[model samples]
Structures are given as C-alpha cells and as structure tokens.
Target: MNISQPGLFGNQWCDAPWRLVQETITGIQSLKSDVDFMLWTGDTVPHVDSGHLSTDLNKELVRNITELMKSTFPTMPIYATFGNHDYHPKHVFPPYNNEIYNATYLIWKSWINDTSQDANFLKGGYYTVLTASGIRIVAMNSNMYYVKDTATVNLEDPADQFAWLDSVLTNASTNNEKVILTGHVPPGFTTPRAVRWMTEAFNKKFIEIVLRHSSVIVAMHFGHEHHDSYRLFYNQEGTAVVSLFLAPSVTPWRFQLADGEIEPPHNPGARLVKYDRQTGKQLDIQQYYADLNKANADKKLIWSLGYNATDLYGIQDITPKSMGNLLDKMTSATNKDFKAYVNWYNTNANTSDKFPCDDACFKKMTCGVRHLDEDSFSKCLTAVSGSVSLLTFSVYSVFYAMLFVAIYKLFN
Candidate 1:
C-alpha cells in the first residue's frame, strides 16, 4: 500500500531539488520480494491551491513520480487512485472541470500505457487486475465521490462511488473471483464531519452490497488516515462483507490527536500484503519503514507509523482460517484496545529526538494497538517463539562455558 501524501509539501517542496526518486528506489529495493503488483494510493504531488489549477510544476512533479516509479519497479504492474489532493481542481475550483483531471490522467496513462516495460496501468482510476491466483484486484477512483468545500471534504458517504462499487461487486460475484478493493479514502473515521457522514452512508450501502456477495469481497485496502487500522463491516446476516484495512501514509505528517499529540509520529513506510488465492486469505501483512537513524539519514525521507526498518514491525500471518477469525476479533475488543494503546502512546510516549517510536513503551504497547484479542494472541505466539530461540542460545552458551572451564582446570 503506497499511500504517500506527497502533495502536502506544496509547490516549493515538490520543486525542491530532492533525490526522492533515489530514496524511493532504495526503499523498494530493500523489500527483497517479487511482488505481484504495486498499488499507488494517490496523492502523488504537492497540494496546490484552487487558483493554481494549471500549475505546470505540479504536473511535472506527478510526471516525475510516475516515471520514477516505472524505472524503480520495471517489472511490476502499477495501479493508481486519486486522492483529494490529486483531485483538487475538480473539487476546489468553482466549475467542475476535467482539464486538470485529464492532464493528471494523461500523466498516469503515459507510464501505464507504455508497453515497453512490464507495467500495466488502468484507466478511470478504477480497474481490475486478474492475478495469477484467479483473484480480482479492483482499484477504485475515490476522487469521484469527494465533495470538497472550503472547510473539508466528505469521504465516508460517497453515493456515486457506491453505485459504481455496487456494479463492480456484482460483476466480481458473478465471475466467482475473490476481490480486493483499493482506494484513497477509507470507509470509517467521523472527523472532518462531512467526509465522515458521507463515508458512513457509503459504508451502509457498501456493506449492503458486500453482504449480497460476502464471500467474494475479502479485503478492502486503503490509505488516507496515516495510521494502521482494520475494521470489519458485517451485514445483518452476520456475513462479513468487507474487512477494511487502512495503510499509514508514507510521509512526514502524522495524524493530529485530540490532545494535539501525535503518536508513532512522522515516519514514512509502506505495507507489504500477500494474499492466498486458494482460500481468499491474507497470507502476510507487514508494514516496512525506511531507516532514518543511519549516520547519513536523508532528512527528506520519512517513516510510516509502526515502521521499524525498511519494512513493517511484525510478521503477521493472516492465512484464510486465521484471517476470518482475526477479522471477527479485530472489530471487537481487539480493535478497541489497539486504539487505546495509541491514545496512551500519543499522550505519554516521547518522540522528540527519536526516529520512529522505538522506545520500550512502544514495544510493550504495540501488541495492544489494534484488534486487541487477536494481537494479544499473536503476541503470545511471538513471545513463545522468542523464548524458545533465546533458550536455545542460552543452552549453547552454557555448554561452551562449561567446556572451557573444564579444559582450563585440566590444563592447570
């Protein structure tokens, strides 16, 4: 999940002669995996003011990022969705125009349409990619549903998008392919009240549609809320239609808490998700962070929340059986405790001089961050494995020490 708020930096930030392309290349190379496909969850350029609708510089930035991505991941298929920032011209401008939209789309098209590389880009910011495992990955154009006012935009209740989604879900169901939905804005969070209201409404409609084809709609991945979150939206029949997973932003800006505190603050990272086609299960979901503590750390590079190294903090196995159970628990006590832990960290954890939140408090508290019950169980499993490894090392150390002592005594 590559959801970086690049546009938040503004024109100056985007124009600044930065080696972000190189840093990005390094970050992707560190992952060390042949990914099936890469999802770019929008917001690629700096957010431009409404008046600067025709900013050529912003266009160049978008073009640069797209080109850079192509060079970095030559063989991987790249898909993109627009964020509010990317769709500013459509929303902020008085007249609903498609000039900026067309330009931005053209930029993506240039890279995606290029057949020279092993990349396949989709049109309309929404399209389906049939993976080798027979799973259908749907990337939605979330910008169509956003209605931005001077204050904020509504995200949750996207009626038009919901209609489009309904059609997509219906088609996926008929085809009998497992579905993974990717977009910019997620379906939860009530802040930015208008967006929340829309999202809630959208969720209701989305849940209804998902319930109709519950088994087909497996996971919904998104990035907007710059924190890792998972919520399962179920239908009245107790069928789990969608499991919402929000990816943290790979940018410096962290979510502002109620007390004006930010926890696990201002790090850049991305998620590596592996799905099992046979069982429609998420085999592995890990978050990776760019290391910022090195002697010559690039100040421009940021780490995502929960990012430790060039990857996520933990190795979570969400295989079919585990994922089903995990989703159930995640929406219950498990998720609540996770949120509580974050609140505590924001209020109590000190991140002033640190890179990512790597204090003991964070390590001890991470297990409780989300989906408490499942994470707790996961933590127990991790502890047991850790203990076994430690014990094995200790036994060897003791045996070596005893042998050395015996040899010394014999020599004496």
Candidate 2:
C-alpha cells in the first residue's frame, strides 16, 4: 500500500477524508489471508499549504499511519520508502545532520527495527533487509536526488547511496540471493510533462550499477506518480536489465497540474504482487481499487481487482524488454491495444466508454511512455486536442499556454 497522510484537519491543499482512511484500512485488513507482507512506498504527509506544519504534527501523522498499519496487519512486515512530500517544508528534505532526519528517524526506527538499518536510515534514509526467503529488500531514500529543491539535499553526498547500492548488490550476488529494490521516484520519465526526478546523471550511474548486477536484482517497486505504471531500463547491449512497477496511491487527492483545473479524483488503490519464490522473479501483479465516488454514495467500501500484469500487458514474465515492447504497442497500435492502454491508464473499466483524457491529462500519460520520441509526442499532443472543446475559449487558451510551456520544458 502506497500510504499518505490522511488529507484532513489541516491547512493541506487536498486530503483524503477521514472516512476514506478508515475504509481503506478496513479493506486491507480484510485481505490479510491473501497477503504475506506489505510494500509501503512513502508519502506519509498530506499535500500541505504554505504555512509550516509543526514537527509535532508531522511526527503525529507518521505515528498515526504507523499505528494504523500495525493494527491492520499485526504480524506483517512492511518495507517502505519516503516520498518527496513525506518531508517537511513540502518538497524540501533536510539532510541527516539536521533535526528533520532526527525526528523522522525516531518515528521510523521503531518500525524498521534494525540497529544497523537505523544507522543507515539516519545517514541517508536508506537500508537493506534480508527476508526469511533469502531475498534482499533495499529501501532507498530516492528523494535525495530529487531536482525540485537541491539545497535541502546534502549535495556533498547526493549519489553516495548509489555507491552503497552497488556494494549491497555485490554482496547479495555473492551470496546467491535475489534482490528487490524499492524507492519513491522511479528512474526515468515518470510523467512526460516533466523530466524524471533523479537527475539523468545519477540515473545513468544507478542504471549502470543495476545492469552490472541484473542477474540478482530481480524486480523493482516504486510509488510516486499515484497512478498504475511501469518503467523499463536496458543495458549497453540493448538487453532488458530491470523493470519497475509504479503502485497506485491510497489517497484520493484531487488531480491537478499546478494552476490547472482539477481533473476527476483518482480512485484509492493498492496492489498485491506475486513472485516466483525460488527465482524471485515477478510472476504477476494484481491491482485492486475502490471507487471513491461509489463508496461515498453507498457509505460502504468496495474493492476489486483492476487488472493483472499478464492480462493487461500480455507478458508472462516482467522484463524491461517486455515492458518496452508493450510501450511500442501503446504508442503505435490503433485498435484494442491502444484503447486498452488509454483506458487502463485512466483507470477506466470500460474501454469503449468516454474516458477522461483532457488536454492536461492525456499529455501526462503520453509523456510517461518510456523512450517516447519527439515526433510521436507531438502526434499525441495533436490527437488529444482533436476532440471538440466544451470548455470556454479562455480555458482553452490557458490550456494551450500550459501545453506550450510543457513542450518547451520537455525539449529544453
């Protein structure tokens, strides 16, 4: 579950109602029979407004969420990564030497429960845990390389953790153990409108290290886009190296692009990933979502599988090459495959139905496609706007202006 702070009782921009939080916890608790453990990729705080949310409040939110997880699955082990919004001052995450790290350390140390890991988590908010199945789980503080705010980041050692990762993978490989990596920001093109958060330079070195040990590193999991998506990376020989799964968010935060009008709210969702116990390769991924609108109307929580990896993308084993091929089909295919891509992206159940892919929404999904060429991106821009506009000229103008700015940023 990609958990975030309950969007309530604060000066936050958009938050999930308290009732939704309760419903989400109850829904997960009911699935304990099917789930063995939880992969909680971060964003523990709500999207706050301008004012400084007190440290006490921030820690309280983390504590509350931690307690909720413990209550939901008393014996389940949860591996989590911190999201960009999980820090103080919104996107600004202070380094380990600061009070922020100390505060966060106190909250997470008890949950993480390893003295060695506590030391590492304090230094860089990253650590590695060896599961009983001999699988290595690397929890990374990927926000360290985030581009939005660099000052709060300890530039002196920004990419040091990647070096740490290399060492971890080397040891895991030597021990004949399979590895799973978890982080908040994925390596590349998380969304088309903006470049990936981990600077290309860092991502390059990170991928190089990953390819060097791809045999042991079986799968990667991440959550930040708040949408169901996947990313692929290839080695120098153009062979598939790694694949990352982007988990859907639990918060029903209203969807907006800065000053743009809010689109339809995303349904709250989570995933259950199954793996080949012996090989550590992913067997399948099952995504489940609750219709927030329907839940609100009926005052009853309902959850169901949105889809599985194999049925949606047509791949038995998740590899970077397989995901890349799927992306090609999504960008070029004209019939059911294309429609499926768009509908699954929108989280719409019916492909024939008029799904919401407004100018702002459509570009985001297109841009997120891995290795998307400029010409194809331009075609996507045109196709989205081809539909007749019901919005006024003023709104249309603003949309175009934003689109122009987005294109400018994409190129420059």
Candidate 3:
C-alpha cells in the first residue's frame, strides 16, 4: 500500500520506491481483461516520516491513489481497508477518528455500493458489501490489532469490531451467503521468527473468528507485509480452516530480519486474483512484479507473473484439509527447493541473483508454518535449525524489543 514521495528513496529502510508507482498502476490496468475486481488492503501513505505527516497530507495521498485506481479501471470495483500509515500521527486509528474516516470514506463511496453501510465505515473503517450474486464481502480495519501503545487506544472499540464481525458473519451464515473477508494486517505473525505485526492476543482472536465462520467464508485476503506470502489457519485437529493470501505490494522496500540482517531491495509487486463469480471461491492468485532496474535503464517496463497459487504451492483444492496438508509439507526443512521458491517470489531482488537467500532468510519464510500445526511444525523447525543459524534464544528476546522500539519511533 505504500507509494509515497515519488522518486525519493533517500537512505531509509523499507521506504516504498514511489517513482515506480505510476508504472504499477499501468500494470494493474492491464489486468482488467482478467480480474473481476480489486481488493486493496490499505497503506497508501509512506512509512517513512509517517508520524510527522499532517492529517491533510495523508488525506491527499489517499485521494490521489484512489483517483488513479478509478481512472485505471473505471468499470471494476475496488475495495480498500486502512493501513497503519494511512492515519496521520500514524497508527492512531480509533473509531472516533471522525474527520479522517469521513474524508477517506468519500474517496471510496461509489465502489462500496451499499449506502446504508456508510455510517459503520465512518465509525470504524469496516463495512460489508453484498454483491448482486449474493456474495458478502467484508472489509475490516485491522490496523488496530498491530503492535501499538494501548494506553492511547480506545480499549472498548477494538473488541467492539470483533463483536460486530461475529454478528456480520452470523447473519451471512443464516442467509447461506458465501463470504470473503479482506483487511490490511493478516491474522497471524508474519513469521515465527517473532511477532511482526499484530499483537499475539488479537491475532489469536482474529483466527478464532475466522475458524468459527470458516464453513461460510469462501476466502480471505490481506496486504501490509509487502512480501508475497500466505497463512494457513487450522483447527485443533490440524485441519486447515482457510488460507489467507497476503498480496505483495507495488512498492519496493527493504525487509529486515530478526538477526539484524537487512534484505536486498525488493522489487515492487501486485496480485491479480481470480475467483468464481457465482460461488465466490478463489481460483488462483497471479503475482506481478516490476523490475525497477530494467525500468531505469530505459527498457520497456515488464510486469511478469511470478507464479499462480495452485502451480506454486501445489494445493489440490481450497478446502481446509488440502491446504493445511500442503502447508505442512512446504514448511518441512527437507524441502529445500520450496523454501528457495518462496525467497524468490517474495521480492524482485531474487531476479538477478545479486544476493542469494541464505539459511536465516529461508527460516523466516518457514516460521509462519508453526501456526498451521505446532506439534509437527515445531519438529520441522527443530530439524531445520540444525542446518541454519536459527538465532540464539537471547538474541530473539533482544530482537523482539528492538523491532518494537524501532517501529514505534518510526511511526510515532
């Protein structure tokens, strides 16, 4: 979601390379022939200096991006949610942020369809849109679940969103309507390396909500990790409930690992997801990434498909059992090739072989696997650690605190 300060990268880590954003929009428009709609999971503002940005500036950024998307695909419906950087004085997105919510709501008015849901969107950037085919699309403001200072937050409102979600899903189930939920932050940690985005407590609750409604939920989507990845939510019996796709961003930013390792610059990426129009089941996700190096050389900009969900991950179907089984195998250390594929698909940096992914980099990709089946997954990680640097226990402790301090200061 980050496309800020076009042409400005400066020296900041993970700053979205804004110069390529226009090209990204062009690439997205080219997908109109294939995709039915777009799900933009938040963060239109730059992460760099986010806390210092005024509310007006943030609004302008959101407006500009929205206008561009509409112009690019005027006929296709585009739905969005709030990213942490979308709010000014960054990450302060309570339901009471009336002015901020009102301004942003108008930008997405036409695409949202249901006028009756505007009040809910205004109160908290969450709403439901029922399609002409009776499929329910629930958009959530998941930024509230991220690591933040709880003292400044509205304690009751965060829980209120979950209650509201319970009611929405219950109604959707009663009507026998298939549902697809979309949001910014995914419901689990980005990696078992450590909790990267949402608090552990909130993440568990979010997963429980998804599991309770898994029977009726067709699929779920998220953004914010910027890297291409997916989460397999499973029940106590190790059966997968749903596989949440975390669509990569159209902004190239650096990713830092827990071991003080800074990854090479990632190429900006986007996803073209196809779903069955009637049943609301996701068929596959086509990942497209822009090569910044080639674009800068006056070469024609190319947005190539990295891979499709089915071809890449080898899941037989969308059902929980099939996907959970696929994830269990992928996380196993014995499958070195799959680990390497994830490293490559995660970003454009892997394109030139300038910096090959090492053991530590590969571990971060598998860390999310534990969420799928902890008992067996722990055994897999233990075996994998024997061949990789799996950082010392003390280092993990310090890394967690260090990341919190770094992100808190950056977003403050």
Candidate 2 overall Cα lDDT vs. reference? 0.60
lDDT of 1 by residue, 114-196 (tens): 34221112223455566555667677655554334322234343224455567767887787778877777555432211124
Stretch of 10 with least lDDT, candidate 1: 397-406
TM-score ranking of the models: 3, 2, 1
Looking at model 2, report the run of 10 residues with the lowest lDDT sum: 397-406
Better of 1 and 2 by TM-score: 2
Give the root-mean-square deviation of each candidate in angstroms. 15.0, 10.8, 8.5
For candidate 2, write residues 1-412 as lDDT tens digits.
Answer: 2334322211012455555555666776675364545677877666554264656566666667767767776766677677777676666665555565666677666556778876677777788987656568898888876766465343635636877898999999889999888888667665534445666566565667777888888788887776666666556565556777777777655456676844443566776777765667676676677765555456576877788767877876456666666655553324355556555554553322334555464355544554323333344445544331200001110000000000001111
Per-model TM-score, in order, reads 0.63, 0.79, 0.82
Candidate 3, residues 1-412, lDDT tens digits: the string is 2424223321224444333555567766675463446677887877656546788888887887788778877887777788887887787677554788999888898989889988788888888998655668898988887766252243644736889898999999899888888888676655534355666566666777888888888777778776666677666675667777777666555566557865455666776665666666656566676666556455456778776656766765444565555555654444744564565445545454344445554565555643533333344456546543221101110000000001111322
Q: Residue-pair clashes per candidate, as listed?
A: 26, 2, 0
Q: Candidate 2, after superposition: displacement of residue 2 in Å?
A: 26
Model 3 / residue 306 / CA error / Å: 1.6
Q: Top model by lDDT, which number?
A: 3
